[model samples]
Target: MKDSSHPQATPPHPAEDVLDHLGYRLKRAHAALRGAMDQALREHGLTVPQYACLEVLAARPGLSNAELARATFVTRQSMNVVLRGLQDAGLLTRPATVEAGRARPASLTDEGRRRLNAAQGAVYAIEARMIETIPGERLSRLLEELDGMARALKD
Candidate 1:
């Protein structure tokens, strides 16, 4: 009963073609990016979380564990573990007790800055490679679209 002469008539997309899904593509891209960053950061003796913490601390100077967890899109417990490891490595410092509130603010040690500086080059290089894949004119639009997608899901 269907008109075969109609040009718009097409078969339904197969469910197995996950690559055609926007979420699947986004997830795949994120996984690839994470893997690349992890490999690059490993050479600097830093994990992704460690690098993120240091990067945030370097910019903000002092941030509570909860603040960091939110910023890094991780759980507070995971951030605490990362803080502990970084502290043990002498890359960051936080007082054992807080005077005003329960939150112990964290900051990077001098060594942390040095290490972050060393790692930045490799990280930037990786970013550059990613950016190179997209056209320069479309970069801003792509970023805005990505942000829009995130906001749409978040709300």
Candidate 2:
């Protein structure tokens, strides 16, 4: 049916008690993590988005802006800006002209690798702190449930 092509988006109903809502708790955790990351990345002169792009590029080189944007949970436009800033900082490289299509592949330079490696310690420390807060046995189940929640929302 033609109606199948146009699915309606339904907003989630909020719980009566905001404090007891899963969304509230998840957002609080996210905000806390982001604040910590902001402080940690600031010491190394990188924003969270910038650091995310570098980390993703280091792991998988020669990814285009659109690909990087998807992998880093950012928009393609935002990724372009992040890539340009990194390139200007001598942390990464993008071709002057596209060798083929519109997508110009991006890769981290030696300095980018060095910077990411340095920033990893602080980032990892933050993760370690979070891990310590949760019970050891529950961590895996927590991750699984979080993944399930994300998948559910996507559907």
Candidate 3:
């Protein structure tokens, strides 16, 4: 038998209490963030995919539908629906006919830019609130750690 002089350090988030696995915690965090974004984006008249598409297009104009679908982590079929809705809403534009390749590229309209800029305030606020939960100095380290975790799972 070993001496019980030194006790184990309790984790900040104790195991099985929060389902304390890193992946499960990550999923939980993602779910919460998604829920918050969905509510905020709804007020801006955008679905999450539409907002994501607008954000991506604003940064990189004229991305093909296939490229967009990949960038947004959605299926091409789902992105087709998003593109159609955005087009119908006059938030984005695409050629009526395909360009060189099978997929037509997309660009945001003026209205799209206006809406995205408005929605960004809410989105950034939500992110800022999340960041406030951790120490300011840890913010960059947290981001790097999150990226590291993602890279570790890429295989």
- Could you tell me the lDDT of residue 105 within candidate 1? 92
Tens digit per residue, CA lDDT, model 3, 31-90: 999999999999999988999999999999999888999999999999999999999999
Score candidate 1 by lDDT: 0.91
* lDDT by residue for model 1 (123-146), tens: 899899999999999999999999
Q: For candidate 2, what is the lDDT?
A: 0.92
C-alpha local distance difference test of each model:
0.91, 0.92, 0.92
Candidate with maximal TM-score = 1
Look at candidate 2 and tell me the lDDT of residue 45: 99
Deviation in Å, model 1, residue 148 alpha carbon:
0.8
Candidate 2 per-residue C-alpha lDDT over 53-138 given as tens digits, one digit per residue, 9 for 90 to 100: 99998889999999999998899999889998999999999888885799989888999999999999999999899999899999
Q: What's the TM-score of each model vs. the native? A: 0.88, 0.87, 0.86
Instruction: Name model 1 segments beyond 4 Å from true.
Output: 1-16
Q: Cα deviation of 153 in candidate 1 (Å)? A: 1.0
